[model samples]
Target chain A: MTSPLEQKKIRITGPSVVTANRTWDGAVVYRTAKQGWSTELADSAIVSTSDDARALLAEATADDVGAVGPYIAPVELKDGGKVKPGNLREHIRAKGVTIDLQVPA
Target chain B: MYAYDELDRTLINERVSEFRDQVKRRLSGELTEDEFKILRLQNGVYLQLHAYMFRVAIPYGTLSSKQLRRLAHVARRYDRGYGHFTTRQNIQFNWIKLAELPDALADLAEVGIHAMQTSGNNMRNVTSDQWAGVAPGEIEDPRIWSEIIRQHTTLHPEFSFLPRKFKIAITAAEHDRAAIKIHDIGLRLHKNADGETGFEVLVGGGLGRTPFIAKTIKPFVSGRDILSYIEAILRVYNQYGRRDNIYKARIKILVHELGIEKFAKEVDEEWKAMGDVGLTLDHTAIEEVRSRFSYPAYEKLPHMPDELKQAAHDKLFERWRKNSVSAHKVQGYSIVTLSLKPVGGPPGDASAEQMDAVADLADKYSFGEIRVGHEQNLALPHVAKRDLPVLFKALDRLGLATPNVNLVTDIIACPGLDYCSLANARSIPIAQELTRRFANHDTADLIGRLHINISGCINACGHHHVGHIGILGVEKNGEEFYQITIGGRADENAQLGTLIGPAVPYAEVADVIEDIVEAYLALRDRPEELFVDTVKRLGVEPIRERVYATR
Candidate 1:
């Protein structure tokens, strides 16, 4: 059985965005309508259909120098065109680690 | 603690240079992600959720003061100001840039540390008992043999690309602190009837989707032929180990399918055919390796010195000493375990400042060497008994003196979904909550020696299968649910835990664990009866009934 990552089958039941990590820095990134990558999820090109999601992911992956592992991730489009991640994983990814890291004084 | 020679130093420097060029090529589109993934992973660079994660090997969990300080510097300079110590007895920097990994590795190389084969499907860092040399009544210091195996297995040509990843653990003490039985290849050094030391070689033990306790294939293999014996086992495995399915790829599966008897026969045949040329560990070769490590100059003193006698009046110091200190082979000394599992904090995490402080403490109280425990803690292996009070106070100031070693609060957890891309749930949060549930140290001491290992997924990175109580996270209906297991243990008689009832929702995990402990406390015949022992006597049904009593 293939894992969810290995399957890579997009089923955009609701609002989604094309997401990846920056190639050099390995930071979470989203594809914008301007055909570029942004670190902010708010700047992502939201798609609701599977076909549109696939197309957006394809376009995002083409920016191999800017992004790596472009895939469609589900999200819940909130008030004022804002997007809240559909799951805990994307929530942490969009922000940072959920727990407070113990940085010494 | 083995000092690096010119050869070891040169290899690491060359590796750093090669990696720099590789990163340059990757950036220039000369190497695709598919090709670069393997190369990066070979150097222990993993693409975690937020950023690239770099894991550095603290080989056999040993580090000198200079090396620890260097790690602290790397934590401050190249990545985040903290690093997570892993159950495999290594340190991982969660926040790292792919562009800067080469430089970080170069800094590590100056102190003879390298991440080579730390992540790939190759020989990982060899693990041993943290109190190897200090623990009393052991056959020998397991690190001596561990270093020998490390040299033999480092970038080994034939075994590098095996069917799946392999892990090896060594323990010389009878207490089995290293959890050797859960490793792919577990070596327990022991004496035969003739009073000659040899290895009790066990193979095919592992955790994950499928868990199995290792079976002893050979009761004894002479010290001289240990490498040849291990090589024989690997050769047989390389030929017969399944690679068609990733889940079934581990040598444990092969040993399970082929049966231990048949597997042992095959290894015996291979060992008979394999010639011991340079592989024999003779006295000269053994002494040569021993000469590399320097021992601490021990001072003669009474077992209970004046300082400790006076300090014992303090209630807090007594609690810390009773729980965190262990007897040493040498008189007037003890092995001190610095708890990384502070309550409500991430297990095994230490800030750069904390690392530097520990380095200073090691140089002060103990020898200038420290050992990382497989249970996600640090050990000061040679602390003078007279200095215990001062060391305790110093560690307390740094918030590293949690009196909960081997207690339920000393939870072992994987980075889980928060950090690991493969996780189904966040283990740290669960561990944090559970540790909070048992926040009182006196209550923890009263409960006594219950291990709770949590894994974010079935990958078993947290060694949940061997925990006295294991919690495995799974995604159910897009929400995290935890499956609880009971009666598991990692010891001389290692066994996998049995699942009890259905999976519980994330909100109910901690309470359910509390209910199980409540049942143990109620059902136990005496105060000394452990949670695992109670489960063994009455079975999980009793505990399960009590846990699901409310539901």
Candidate 2:
């Protein structure tokens, strides 16, 4: 039987990357091209297919050197090689805070 | 207001040192994520969606000007220059780095504050009526007993690893400002027939997936024996509270399963077995705590100051005064609740500069004291009536003066899916939308005393179960949906809200609320009857019909 986490994993239709919060600061990070964690989403190792996404997620989970709860989340690769999270939650996560981050001087 | 003694300070310092070492071990890969999670939670550190969140306890909602300044400094230096005040009367820094938490805690310790027991499956912060000492109809100062409970429960050896998280609240006022009936242990201090101060202890009250109004286990526990009795209750819960099911772990479930009578009998037996094992309060210690919370040096002024009388005629000042000011026990003083719910902003988020300004205002207007009300607002407990206009103007300049306290615009919301990992849907945006929709002061004034509480999940961090109008977010098939409940109240007569209809999409929440308010307006006997009272008189049927009419 598949684990609950695996069962919850949706069918990957687009390019995806394994993302999680960094263990030290809980900042949103992605599994990088060099098998390390990167704060920049553009540097993430994007897997093209479901099998590749699963493999990437498995590798990210097994490493456990820098992140917690690594999971495959879909991302959109822009023209300038910029990466954006597909969902609102992840978008907000990438931005750090939901509301305006500015504080009055 | 109770100043930490040598022992208190030492314990906090030791705890911080211990946590620092724990953090070091975790970062160095000596501790696993699961192992570190428990330790971090015990110290009020949460790994949220974006960053680590650190919650600091404001003991019984009391803070000195110096402590407030320290909080502001922490916000400015460590966090994103802002902090969110919670419904539990605690402040949460959402953008904290885990590595810097130890240093942040050290800074907090200098001001006699710590985050211990603010989280974890231990006894959390001991909250009391915000106007405990100063409220007009208070029987006794509940903060004294709250302080006593805080001292006793802070890292108690046996109860540290309880079945689940526990909360204790105390109220000494005729009006239940502390929401006592909805805590794990709600201690209501009142004068008995013999004119002696005693407690009416209620146990098993909680809000989460399961909401319960606490049952009176012991109707009258005397002042000296309150700790021992509480220990007895805790012992009973520790022994019999369910551990297998996380959902059924709170003491409320245990009390529910065993029945209040059986639970009371077990507590009584436990109390008898303990035989006053160092839990009784000594007169000197009690007096020492009382002395720390002495009345501020109030001047001998007449009942109504000329400035206040002059300001009362000004429409804006009168509007602010009508909503913000409450009668104090002292004739010349008033309890001023500064609304944290500004238009189109998160309900209780305050910037570092705003916190500093509030501290300064407290010093100038009040007696250098600040209070965190359970309604997610700050209070200047002893503001002289003469300084009303000046204080109002200063607050207005800071954008803190939203004359909508207890009105529809004053929403209480949790940091839902936006920040919390456990939340399925967002609460802040919903609160923002509601506040924006109800920005009209005339409309809000017409719909008086409506407490709209939104929780992201069933944990009920927003106290949605006790809200006059409660909104709970649930995810259905990966889409965010909201369930609305009405006729709930968190006052002397506490009742959990009844669900109005089927869950509505997020976009329709404000419309549903408006429809319910319209239903109330149509069905009410008079305008003077409150929304909750009108709902009680006419059942949820009228509102439910209107809400689901088109469907």
Candidate 3:
């Protein structure tokens, strides 16, 4: 019987990617090779190995000037090499808000 | 509204300069993210799922037209052309750049607006009745006391780093529009038999992971002693509140654990010990602060002008008048609620253009005064009775004249998973769907005075716990669902809603609400008995059975 916070502390399984928000404009970004951050999930450097995930996350976390709150999140690999966020929350973040916003006159 | 003095302006300008420096330091890599997060939060900047969100305080929900126009400018210049008015009587911009927040704050500060104390473990904005000054039967304007508390608690050294975030609400009217019972400290202005005014103090009520209706700690605290009495409560809470567990750190938990009697005793002792703290709220002091507020010079006009009578002939304007208009303390004026919950529109969102339009209307019709209510609607606090027809047409042109103030269609929904990082599901779409179902004015007017509040999660930002019809979104098996509750209300008789039954999927929420409405319509004692009163008269079992029977 673990608490929700403690459960979150456990390492996620399967392929994962490091994601954060750009500090300047707060755009959602993902970590890539060479310590790069990209707004596109397709460009994100996905890793399966736990050590590789930890290393990528640590690199993004340390570079606070470029990004903030970097963490490794599980990703789902679809048919034809298509990769997207594994959950609805992450999918919304990668895309945008779910509804058509009211355009004020 | 209270105007800012030179000292207030200087203090905020200095704050803007300091925050600009902090943002610059963070961007230049001189400060860590951990270090800058708290600093940014102090200035009302929060890192959300998609972007940085900024919140600005509209103290006691009162905003002059000038201040409102400035907000419109901020929306267009800094955000995505709109802002969200929250349940706490504050406005939030969902897409602010962290770098540009300082400039935004400065622009707002030019009109004496800031985002301070909107977040973090400090005394948050002091909320009060939106119709405070102009209401018909209020004891005194609660904004005066709310302002006094705001001045006392703004950056007060002792309560700065409290155990948890503290919220205080004050209401001068008997109708309890401020929802005072659901705050850390609730003050209701009361009148004694001798015509002297005082505050009936309540303590330790909140809604988040846990919800509690605040209990009265003191039945009466005289006008001269209200400030001292509040200080005594805060001191007691600061001394004895839980710090060991973050989940159990609110003053509500302390009051619950210590028991109200014991807590009241402790507060009494503290009040007695602090013999003569010179913060006496005497008549002279009260009049001095009251003098700072420039009230509208109202004309002595007759009741319900001919223009309003002529406008009532039109069915649409009649419905809008019946729902969105209320009696004012002034003879010829009315309090007009401009609905933000248009059919299929997002709740509480005002585009920059809409904000500008509202400011224009406020200037033209309402003595340049506007209010943001805790129910996510805007109110023109003082509108001439003769001006109702013109105002309704103006609001209709702006798509804000949805005649559903207390109706079921006037839903309160948080920016759920759509924008909030902590949300478990989406609330806006459900709210939109429900409104779409009840968009017919006749249907909505028939099901009158039913409040539906939706929260994305248990944090209750939308005040689901106190709604007549409460909807709490939950995640189960990686899918979105909602738990519906009944009988909750926000007034003198504030009570948390009881769960009806099991969770329903996203697609079925509107139908569930329909079932609840049908159940109430079928079983209510009379048309005047509200949905909550019906639920109270007959327990939720009948409603639950009817709702699930359709399943």
lDDT tens readout by residue for model 1, A1-105: 112366456777999898888989899998999999999998889998989988898898777778777777889977887788878878888989888786433
On residues B1-551, what C-alpha lDDT tens digit does candidate 1 reach at each position?
78988988988899899999999999888888888988898899998888999999998899998899999999999888999999998999988999999889999999999998888888889999999888999998889899988988987889789888899999999999889998999999999999998999999999999999999999999998999999999999899988899999999999999999999999999998887657888899988888898789999979989999999899999999999999999999999999999989999999999999999999998889999998999999999999999999999999999899999999999999889888988899999999999999878988999999999999999999989999999998788999999999998978889898899999999999998888899999999999999989999998899889778
Q: For residues B135-210, could you state the per-residue lDDT of candidate 3 as single tens digits?
A: 9988888888888888888888887888888999999988999999999999999987788899899998999888
lDDT score, candidate 2, position B132: 80
Clashes per candidate, residues 3 or more apart or on different chains = 0, 0, 0
lDDT of 2 by residue, A1-105 (tens): 011133475568888888888887888889987889999888899988888888888888876648877887778888887888866567767775566544332
DockQ of each: 0.55, 0.40, 0.56
Q: Which pairs clash inside model 1?
A: none
TM-score of each: 0.98, 0.95, 0.98
Worst window of 10 by summed lDDT in candidate 3 chain B: B285-294
Q: Rank the candidates by TM-score, best first.
A: 1, 3, 2
**CAPRI level of candidate 2:** acceptable
Fill in the DockQ of model 1.
Answer: 0.55
Q: Candidate 3 clashing pairs? A: none
Residue-wise C-alpha lDDT for candidate 3, range A1-105, written one tens digit per residue = 011222244266788898888999999999988679999998899899888887887788788899988877778999987889978877888999988876548
**What RMSD does model 1 have?**
1.4
